[model samples]
Target: MPAYQLYVYEDQEKREALEQKICEQVDACTEVNGKIRNRVKKFLIEEGITDISEMNAALRVRYEGYLERNETVHVPITCLRGFDRIFLHRMKEELKTLAGQRKYTTEYRDQWLCLTHYPDVEVAESFLTSKDGKELVWNFTLECPRKLKMQIFTVLKEVIHTYEGWTRKEKLLALQRLYQFCVVNQVSDIETMTLEEEQKFALKLSEDLGEKKKNAVFGILRMSRKILFLQAPEINWNANVWFLERFHFSKERINPSKPVELVSFKEVTNLENQKILQKYLRYLFGITDLCISTIRIKLLELRTFLVYFNGEEKPIYEVEAEKIQRYLESIQRQDTREKTANGRIFMILQFYNFLVVKRYLKKIPFRYEYYLQKEVHVHNDRSVPEGVYTEILSKLAEFPEHLRLMFLHLWCTGIRGSEVCTLTGDGYEEKDGDYWLKVYQVKMKTYKRIPIPEALYKLVQVYKKKYQIGPEEYLFQNQTGGAFRYGTFRYQMLKYCEKYQIANGEYIFKSHDYRHNLATLYYDSGISLQAVRDYLGHEYEEMTRQYVDYMPKKLEKASEAYFQEETHSFAAELMKGEFHG
Candidate 1:
């Protein structure tokens, strides 16, 4: 009496008797599912549909009857549950067989009508090709009235076909949630949702999802509204307000792996504050020469500054030195680092200056120097140790090809992690009998060209060919076909490092350290500070100096050189015997 064999039982009476015995045995068990008992009792009492094939026949007859009545066919939950236990696998096989026979059975309305089995083939196929047809046809179903569902389906058909790439999925997911919200609120049409209704839906999303997902969904909704509005002009949405509340930064400029809140600002509460922040952001974008990355940082810093005054009775325009002081103290209380705290203070001062210039404030409220800290720029010795890197290289062949190549970029060229992740297929060029690599420096907002080892160039060429990367496409792409995220690279590197037990199982790989190593290596080999500055894309000679980690051996050599010189120097003469020995 195998469970699956019960589906093909011909003798109804014997099958019912055996099903009763099985139910009794299940009920006697301590761990029996209550739903199973309930379903079995309901099936036996109400319908007495024990045979699986007969159950399918009954459902088919019901479906035909609904079609005759010009209605959507409905399947009961109990039957679906029973199918889950017995005929779920068989149903899938049957679907495949029906497809082979040129009869498609795609699910349209969940537990209701099949797209192919509908009364009208043309209309059903039209729905199949609409929206994210392939996925939506199989994955989702509308549970509203026929008219409303059709209206939504029409809009979604456009949405799925209109938006491109990853955005299509995002629009679909957000729209599904929106559809549910519409049904719950009894909103007849999605296109005619008022601003108030949209706001209420946003609030509902906030309550339902976590902060990160809420912001992401908010961004998707905001972006998808353009097409939505074009298709349905009656919709009333405050694009300006929504844009400032939560929106995505340019994907080309911002790393996807960065914290969502840092890239997308949603903290400013007051409408006035949001407008001011929006104005500032626009000013930064249009007027300033600052790069998008730098502007994002400044915008995030300013958002924190503005959010502190969210509940204040007075607006942010009424700036006072005491309030600024309190903000500084509050930031300090969080154990903020000196350099970071100084950067934040600088941002605040810059914003206040901008306010004065824009006539938002008659005068500057506070002295910038009064609140600023004198940050001591300490050069951190972040160069990867020789032993650690050597061990990594020893096991590098066993690692994934992408990681190996990325590590080589870090190890040889000393490029930033972000730069490595974003390297384009066209970044490599041949000039003057040497191979050069070009990388877009996000921090500097410029392109930097530097010579690379010939071996690495050949390897990259092979990789590009293998992956079929186009000229403008990223050399290393993520699962979503965007630039390989820096965070993901770092995460994978650490995992592999731990797996391979690099540096005796304790080395925490920092991508920036490779930059330090190459800088130091070049300086020690007699490359000038100016040349290093240009090579590292540092705007200042002093910044390049910080990156060059002068190891103890290099210091010893410098000391020896100074002491061994014939010219009389105070330090050389003072330690003459020690140096001579």
Candidate 2:
């Protein structure tokens, strides 16, 4: 009823002699006759008679019905060698063809038989074989062990064959099938098989010759299957094998000729030794896409290097520098935009030095020294009057209740519009008689607690009551009852400003501009630069100083007088001129 099973048996010398006789007859046949020759051969071999001429006499004396039924025919080893060699040789050829076609490579040898490529041995006395194989070898006085089942050695072999020359994804699937077979079959002691056994197994499965002549064949098959199944497509199986062979299998010689190359941003792109140039454009000037129109020339130069040096062994740093200089010279000859070119070159030089310090490159190229320049900080020229805030607040009153509160929150706390949109009930906290919202600034990588003004707090209460605020709800939920994204919030703010005609129609401001406005206001209110910096959570005082220049002249004068102990009238005079209260 089952698809297949295994059988073990114990056979003494008599049974062994009979099986050997049958094997000899099979081996001697050059071409098989009809059933008569088969019957005669079986009888002579099983009865242990040496000659077919003596078969009748020996069978009649020993047992009856020897010729009556085919199963009754049994031969002995002594009689097998004496059988016609032509008939025996044919039988052997037939058996070998059958085994090969069925993917069975095992062969019988004398009384003791060795399975092809399989580690297990079947002796004359205690022979363990699969059920089907046993059926073919029955009538030899051998018995099957009830519990033993057929072991499909062919499954592993076939898997190994299938994985060869397969693509990464295909190899992975093949390995999965192999593992499933092992788990399902409960195969154990795979390592016990000798090199002969493994080779035999491989020969049985497929005709292709594997690289490893002996024992390593099995290991290589297993490893390759696993790699194909478990690792990503980008991961190189051959490279991994080479690494393992070099390190783990020290004695084994594996030399891979064409190794994969690792490319960098610049190497892939082909910019000259302009490390500083690239860095400045990318980081300082905020030009993110070097391959775009902004830096097309540099990108083209990098592309040329990649093509010219294709498959060549060259240090990436050197290649990058050479390509960058070529581009620079080309731009100079053409009388292109000198300012932009110089800026790029300078940044590249700085970036080169940085890479050297990080040990990514060995040496800073000589051209870097010529391009190095000290960085300068420029002041913004935008200025706003004190009345501008009041005017914006009045325009915000014309919008919906929630919009009004959102504007007030942004203006009062100096938080970004996106942060305001993302605010939820959980962000609000009360501590030491002060209420504040915890702002998660992604770029800053820290949470900021911005104090809520009284006016804004009252407005929030009104907004919450109107919306029937829930505990886990966003404070500024959109139509989907979820927090608004940055783009949506910005759009809404711009729309409101347009509709209200606020700040002389110059009410356009980014979410970040609020922080700048707050910093300026804080400095004008006579707060110490350090105090303002702490409140804003700025790492450097220089960043906070950007707002200092924007402070009202009156406040600036007051600060100067306070520090220098000059005339107090200086503050009054400066305020009269600068303040439009």
Candidate 3:
């Protein structure tokens, strides 16, 4: 390391002369500027820093140290600022004359230095300026072998190019920790890292980092092994998960509440089983009309079933009806819900059907209906309680403007939460005096237009105008300018409801509940069942009936209307007997 020059003067006469010069510089400034300078001068004289050195950089550093150690240091920040303005700036020319024209010295940072040791010079140069590289601490990778360093850099390059925000930062941190572990263990090849070494690294991380941080690091590493090392034959970390975005699902226009991101087959450790599952997924995603979300659920259910039979020596093709019965019994022993259990069995049956079509299996293993539990479709009261919604409306001003408007959409229209999230600016239309809002129902896979409150329509127009939203843009959007996530909306609404103590802090906000509320309200207002069904975007009136709650009032109203009529046979006889018999 090159030593920085210290210009501390030992002679008193030279120190006094330099102090006088600094004082003279202060005197030339106005009173406001001179106040802080005067403090710096007084501080220097008190410290007996009558040392003048050609290296002003070194001199300033020494002065800073004195300021820190001194107990009675007054306005140190101001004094430091004054030191730079007067000593460094005003006296720069004089100092340069004393030590020739070398005003600033170069100090090589470890980050820049590590580049020389990197295997690929051009890659290092490009990476040095990349987003991930700019923030990396080079000390962790300094002693790692060329191949290991190259692997780390490659992963980082992919991470920088692929991800963004805190996700990118987190993956970078995960890689850095991995690099440090590699360097310490003298492991040169990350691709050939052993399972034992992987376990050791995880244990070390858990000890050094807390449980949460360690888990996060391991999660990122697992994801990187799947994503960044796609062509690599093997990696130490066992991650049989794959991100769905790589398959171009975006083109399909399927954006679900919980994004269909990764599918994990880690439970099914058999490589042949994994390949079979992958082929099934590819078939579902490509050939079938099934929604991506539906496909994801099927994949999860299949993974569980495969995990159950993982210990078996036989391949999935050779599984007989007897084994299938055992698997069914094992699942039945668990405390799974009837509906969920039935769904799981149904998915397995579907998978078997797919296998038969592809010639992987000679025939289906067992009768699907025999294993399935009878599922009763009992509808729960999902409507938001009157007290809860009324309370929300009472203090609606307290919530954000956007949220308040979104609530109105749910309150006024019996639309789904997903439809509310994906409302576009041009979805609103005015015909003569009536206002109508058009929304695409993701579930029904169609657009539905219904009359909306004039006030609500105008409010939306005003909001769009205020936000400068274009016709093609979503009425409500996330930070990324895409349609706002329904999950995020629900989460934020619940947070605020709890904060403001809505329903005495006991009520959890559910967006779907508002849909039910609107449906019930429409039914109670004497709207035809067919009209309510249409408004709710339901395929059948029977399905819409499930959404209608508070049915007792509607039933009571119907009974009262029936007896009031005198012309009806039973009602007329009762009226005649009471009045003239």
**Candidate number achieving the greatest TM-score relative to the actual structure:** 3
As for TM-score, the candidate ahead, 2 or 3, is: 3
Show the colliding residue pairs in model 3: 9-51, 15-50
The reply for model 3, stretches above 4 Å from the true place, is 1-113, 116-151, 159-173, 179-201, 222-239, 250-253, 330-339, 552-581
lDDT for position 294 in model 2: 26
Question: Against the correct fold, how does model 3 do in TM-score?
Answer: 0.66
- lDDT digits (tens) for residues 14-87 of candidate 2: 56666676656544553444444455555556666654323221233233343324353454321222222332
lDDT of each: 0.67, 0.48, 0.70
Candidate 1 lDDT over 1-581, as tens digits, reads 88667756756667678677555533443332476445544453345454333334335344334334533324343333332333232333345564533433322344433332333344333333333232232223445555456555555666645665467666667766766777778876544445567788889888999777887776644544444444443423322332211333455455433323223334666657666787787787667766566787898899888888877766688756688788876765666668788788888888888888988898877666766676777778888999999999999999999999999999989989988998999999887889999988777667889999999999999999999999999899999887898888999999999999997779998999999999999998999889988999998987897898894467778877885767757665667765577
Assess every candidate by TM-score: 0.62, 0.39, 0.66
lDDT of 3 at 485: 89
Worst 10 residues of 2 by lDDT: 251-260
Give residue 520's error in model 2 in angstroms. 2.4
After superposition, which runs of candidate 1 have C-alpha atoms over 4 Å from their true positions?
1-265, 332-334, 431-433, 479-481, 551-581
- The digit string of per-residue lDDT tens for model 3 on 463-494 reads 99999999989899999888888888899899
Better of 1 and 2 by TM-score: 1
Candidate 3 accuracy as lDDT:
0.70
How many clashes would you count in candidate 2?
46
**Who wins the lDDT comparison?**
3
